[model samples]
Target: MDITLKSTLPGHQNPVFCVEKGYYADTFFTAGNDKGVVEWDIEHNAFKRILCAVSSSVYALRLIIGTPILAIALREGKLLFVDVEEQKLIASLQLGIKAIFALAHMSWKNELLAVGEAGTLHVIDLSTYQSIYEKRISTTTIRAIAIDEGLGRIALGDKDGQVYLLDSTDFHVITDLKLHNMPTTSLAFIHNKLLSGGRDAQLVISNPNQLHDNFSFVPHLFTVYGIYPHPEAPIFATVSRDKSLKFWSSDDFALLKNISREKMQDGHHLSVNAGAWSQNGQYFFSVSDDKLVKIWEIKKIDKLVANS
Candidate 1:
């Protein structure tokens, strides 16, 4: 695949914490230590507008699929539901989480899972948009959550460097492993494997139920903040505090593209906190502590057939 910097967008006054593909086709959203969720148009390389404003720093954002509501996770332990179609705040849910770091929608189960600071996990029934269960699974902050509905597993990573695979139905720990010496900062399930990254600058690929089937490597110089897989391709991207975004092959887990800050003129100079691929897989968006949102244009390589 061939990737290049398409544009650099600057607007956020503070470090950008998270980025997520919006409910729409060509749109995406980003937030951080910012006051509002800013929406951007990927097709025209422009800012759409602030979808809504909140009272605290935004740590995470996710879309409630099949609807106009966007879930905004705030720093003060509150979840805000915003109606993007009307550009208004719909409702709020406070679970006493202290802060929220990640959110995942189990659309198949009609549930939403939110895990965050103080090791709190909140399960909300989308049917009612209310808390179904709230529990503290760890003594420290839980930084990552990945739900595999097909496999019936929920992968949780914590600041204590522990990784747990839980039963998606009951949220019970199925497998437990210490994968990092420092905090496990990110986690994602890709192609039947759980890909985890951490503050120890390491990346690990392992099976959810079989703990012996796994391998680890140091892929960054600092914290690996986010792992984002392409919407359709067998490839994924990991961003880090080292100020670079790395593309890896899911087929062999090989490093394919490294967008390093030192070489790319538009690359992030500070910690690249998070990234998300466009819904159509034509472009990629990354945000950083440098307070810039960068759009990267991607092109899949095509091989011509050999003439007989």
Candidate 2:
């Protein structure tokens, strides 16, 4: 299937680092190396405002569920909370001396986890905005993080191609597995399994508890930049440096369709740096180094059967 470019919203002075959907409105937030977070209104197809600014490049951003607050991570190891509706700075915290790479929020417990370039995890309580627990994993840089509310687990992937599972409540290390030879770039939980992508040009699926076993890798044409699961379907999308978005069936890891920027004729001309699936899962958005954003609608599939 071909991807149609809906529109292009260009305002960032540098490459975008992350894009997140707003919890309470029809808006989306994007953070980039320009040290600012821009709020884009999807319904209007344009940017509404530059929500906030930081001292250094914003490397990570996460929207807390059921709140108007946003967690912004800076390259200088500072995390700030911005109230989106009122456009005010709610709070701010510093993570000592290490640069933060990823951020995740636990909706159930209202806790925020920040991972640093040194593979240190800091768990912060939203109510008091205090650090409850912290752990360091040797000498690896944490690249990605995912929270599993169902199993009370937090997954952390590092630059050395290792994934570590820890108890979300106590921050105890549960298990550690070396999953790839290259840095793990992204992680997503789908269908009772964990999906991971990395610079090794491989996508892997495995059980979160038993990461050392029951693992499978599928080779890709280019470095896998991001992997996101559909909200309500049995499929997910993978973005690569080759400028192609491929949809895969989660059950069997089969490629269902490929969407390339060239096919859309939208002048999409950069390696995909980041991509995200909407909350409703009906549409997906991707941002590239070429300074363009493209949204694609997912097509439903019908089963075909024949009498044997």
lDDT of 1 at 150: 82
Candidate 1 structure quality by residue, lDDT tens digits, 193-256: 8889999998998987754588998888899999887767778889999999988887888898
TM-score of 1: 0.95
Which regions of candidate 2 fall more than 4 Å away from where they truly are?
Answer: 1-3, 262-264, 299-308
TM-score of each: 0.95, 0.91
Residue 31 of model 2, lDDT score:
77
Best-fitting candidate, scored by TM-score: 1
- What is the per-residue lDDT of model 2 for residues 144-203, given as tens digits with 9 covering 90 to 100? 888789988888889998888888878888888878789888888887788888888888
Clashing residue pairs, backbone N/CA/C < 3 A, model 2: none
Instruction: Give the TM-score comparing model 2 with the true structure, all chains together.
Output: 0.91
Deviation of model 1 at 187, angstroms: 0.5
lDDT of each: 0.87, 0.77
Q: Residue 21 in model 2: shift from native, Å?
A: 0.6
